[model samples]
Target: MASDHSLLAHLVPKLTRGVEDAVTDALAFILNESKPCRDALVDMVSVGDRRLASVANARTQVVASEGERLDLVAYDTAGSNRLIIESKFWAPLQDGQARRYVGHLADDGLAVLLFVAPEVRHETLWVKIARQFEHPSELKLGSTRQVGNMIVADVVNGDKRIALMGWDTLLAGLTNADSSMDANLQQLHCLALAQDEAAFAPLHAEDLNATVPRRLMAFNRLVDGVASRGAGEGWMTNKGLRAVPGRDGYLRFIGFCDTDGERLIELALYVSLKRWADLGTTPLWLRIWHKQAIDLVDLKHRLAEPGWLPAWSEPNWLWVPIELPLGVEYEDTLDSATAQVKRVRDIVVEMA
Candidate 1:
């Protein structure tokens, strides 16, 4: 088994030793926190390691716990910049968990909920549950039983994504021999504080805001959850799904891996829409890429629309069909695997 130190040694050395230590400590603190402790902990790690060179003249502290007030709170300011962070945990966003959370955040305008759980299923899981409340019962998304420890559902800019780690995964990463503090794991560990619907982007900065309607929020929750759950259960490909919100909040587009072996190596496009192009909404393609497959369908539907046609949206998908050469082990072609992703991106651009 590879030790964390050995794994770190194998990577490129862009991170200064001090910065690396700070980054590692920040990740460690985040993993150990009961809920997301991003605002408080990020600064702590920065300060402890002198990584806050940029914020040398800032005032930072926790929010006052004035009775009936919510969870942990903190504030940071430097010269003209000021930021606030509020931390809290939510039961898995089910049975209207997201609606309640979104409503609360919208009322406040700026709040970050630090989720405490293992592997924040931010992209796929929570969003699926929220989508359930969006459409009528007839057009709603699906659900699954909550498993493992739940993390704080961080909501920033109306973008909702899971924080990924709680105590268990954090502890496991710290103690497990195979878990290394490498760039891949570290990048994966970087908390996607919110799922920006307007741009389908992930936000990590301290100060950012977005607007999300109740139904739209619910839709995002549903879309994210089902796709993530399906992928995890192996009904679909084990890769993360993609989501794209349409213009005017009229629709959302999504896509994922579809793993049905074909007579020849191939890639497929499955699509779903808000109402008109709602075909293929079920997890039937789970055999391919899990719920991510369905999310892809949603994306295709949007791309096929009049105003939101193919060129309107970027060629947002990049997938490659991979097959092991005869007698070639998977590890033997690690470089090739990476090349395959690059090829897929190239193919997508060509198609665009």
Candidate 2:
């Protein structure tokens, strides 16, 4: 558990008060200096208000506010258009912050509220945060409503219309801008790619084959057989074979097997960390057997055997050991593996 905290801490930087201010400064500079970038932004958020493009090149005033200050406030002098941008790099909106920010723009004529973040970095976490301030009807992504002649891409807090723009979208717009401005935007784009790459590095077959041990490889093949059987029986999705390498440099699997025949069962299914998080506080046992009405006493006793272990309570990972008969040819083990998986499945059905 402590390792998990350390891993997260190492991967994600501690967001300070000034981080948003720095982002605001960079974004404001690009919007004011680059006409193409500004026009793209206006086109994305102001769907019906095409006239906003006229002010894309207008002399703009950009201000960064702290505390009561809305992240970035840009005013176009020529068109008298105001863009109130709330930029969140890592942090979620504080309590009532969204409402207060929208309220600030309520009386400001010809103004739009834009919420910008790197959605890819945080997965759907930022999307869920944005939904909290949104009306139930505006829950879908890219949802829009017309406020008079102005178009609001994401409406929140009753009539407050806001646009949620991802960093990737902003980068695409910046890419089409004049090449002369590459020096300024290149650093930002590189940083964004680095963040994305760190999150999702591709796993190669050769890399796994070379690093993984033979025992683990055998265990993975057995689990793959179990998954295949489950999918064939219409109990699981046929996602094909997946060898998820954990942060600990070990291949994480759903089924476990012991090399010796000391244990009664040859193989049993387990749960992964990602699966645990997806299931929230629900126990893996409950999630797997919830539809069945199994006796708790029998279920507990069977799971308490040397070969069967319940999921961990703290980290919530399921790791049940299964015995594989020793001194058998590696090729001959498949029949046993298949039989074990069927036995586990049968136990579920019988206990139900």
Candidate 3:
């Protein structure tokens, strides 16, 4: 899967989700449904030194013994709460969140209060949470080391400890442990993949480059090419900041015909990922006005042919979405886009 693209994430994008809460819910679902998944998770934590029975259960939005609302809680076979988990994304820890969980540990229960966060936050989160076990608390920061690929921080109170792990590391371990995972695990993995891809990292010196703007300018040139082609085909072209709240800027084409006793119609091709027009399930498509003189039924069927993909909605206006080919070179892709746009326009002219 590409960055920011996941099966579950495609339906619910990362920007709209309460990332911390969503992670907690998805993981809890997988662990509760699959006992092997729970064992896999514990295997990563204990590094094969310990094992979690298949009967263990996982719950989310759990109220800890210390009255703190934890993101996840894992219960052993005997129904004892042995694993207290806190899921973090960008949100800071609540007031004394780590300290209270450490204080809640009895040191005799063999329980672990674990915090899972992004890899970028691994070192800093470990240090920040380790500070909570200082002075009066029975727990002490024992050691920080690499357990396989995970950067694990151990906060020791005799045998029991609080561990910090990265979400990426945890997901990787689980995947390696079980390759034939079910749909829940697969969906959870997709969500994690999207989160990892979307999470912005700390800025580096090499990021200050001109490549980003140069590519944006290339896209502008591509649109200009399409507009030029449309104007040459006897269609009026207009360029403007044509974007709705959820849509991107678009290039438009206007045509005048005597089909409906001399009328003018407009069509626009949006360059955004957002769904400004209803084109079935696809996020990629162009929008066209429904005020046309052509037969609606014939138009719908023809639009469903090889090149065009069209969908009907409750609205009075309909969009003609054309799928374009992505080429390596800028001019190649522009030519492909221009050809597709021309095909759609010609179809309309013939039908009208």
Candidate 4:
């Protein structure tokens, strides 16, 4: 588990993509500035190949001999770039990105192309990346562990190698090499750890067992029950129009109606995880765009009350919130969920 007070954890949402770029920069700095850290990384990556042994210094955002922009390059004593490290986070692999990076290393005669990413991707992401290497599709495709569960794939064409390493594997190597690493490296470790935690871990045996299905089935029952009540009130569901994304097992919020005025007024019970992840946020709310508010100042003033508060969104929107307290029992939570939705509905009714 990551620390509750990790600085990287806090800044991640605010910085958004800047954090990923900053992490790559921080890694390049640590590799160049700290010899112990750099040497340890090289030693770990080198393993049996011994080709990457000469890699001495690291640089960030180097353009390849080819036109592609490489993330990090590890240099050799002879000034030849022997290794390419691709830093990744929550982003899909670009078309031919892996193949192109490895191609850059292949030109060096002896090199390694390493991808450092969150550990959770071991099963999901690596397979997709592995497909990039196929020429009419390679017969042998899929990431494998050759260097202590770090190397994602081991491909040998003459004297070149392709490897995939988890952030955990790389950070552990740095720590194992020097227990008291530099402050920057320590911070990097914390940030990577926090990132993995936030990304959520791969499911284990407990998740695959019988206990989870019953709970999910019960939750589905709740959705069915609530949906039935909402349907009876003549709210348009638009269920067949479009499917919700990332919604788990009937977890999608019902699109109850179309319009309150010129635009639609979304008064529904939901957990807003919009990019910033309002996971533990208020359960009941009305989502209205800024344009929907004919007089923004007046609307803000009108919605200011004890049980309701209006919060603005970026680009253009406001969230009128009301807390929906829930309990473990299905009956109680069902009643609570229904009442909260009705309360939001009544508020919208008054506004109309």
Which numbered prediction scores highest in TM-score against the true structure?
A: 3
Name model 4 segments beyond 4 Å from true.
Answer: 1-4, 106-109, 137-145, 180-182, 200-352
TM-score preference between candidates 1 and 4, better one: 4
In order of appearance, the predictions have TM-scores of 0.21, 0.43, 0.63, 0.55
For lDDT, candidate 2 versus 4, the one ahead is: 4
lDDT of each: 0.32, 0.49, 0.62, 0.62
Q: Which 10 residues in a row give candidate 2 its minimum summed lDDT?
A: 256-265
Clashes within 3 Å, all models in order = 51, 0, 2, 2
Q: Give the per-residue lDDT of model 2 (tens digit) for 143-215.
A: 5454432225544223335665666666666667656566666555544433443354334577578555665
Candidate 3 per-residue lDDT over residues 1-352, each given as its tens digit: 3333356766656356576678788888777766666788777666435443333887888776657677887877777667778887657767568878765544444566778877777776777787777787675777777776565555653545567777767766666666666555567766765666555655656666788556645655666677666665555345432423332544444443333423345655555343432222433345656666666556666778764555443246455554555546766776777777666655667786
RMSD of each: 21.5, 17.7, 6.6, 10.1
Between 2 and 4, whose TM-score is larger? 4
lDDT of 4 at 168: 72
Candidates ranked by lDDT: 4, 3, 2, 1
Q: Against the correct fold, how does model 3 do in TM-score?
A: 0.63
Find the 10 residues in a row with the least total lDDT in model 4: 261-270
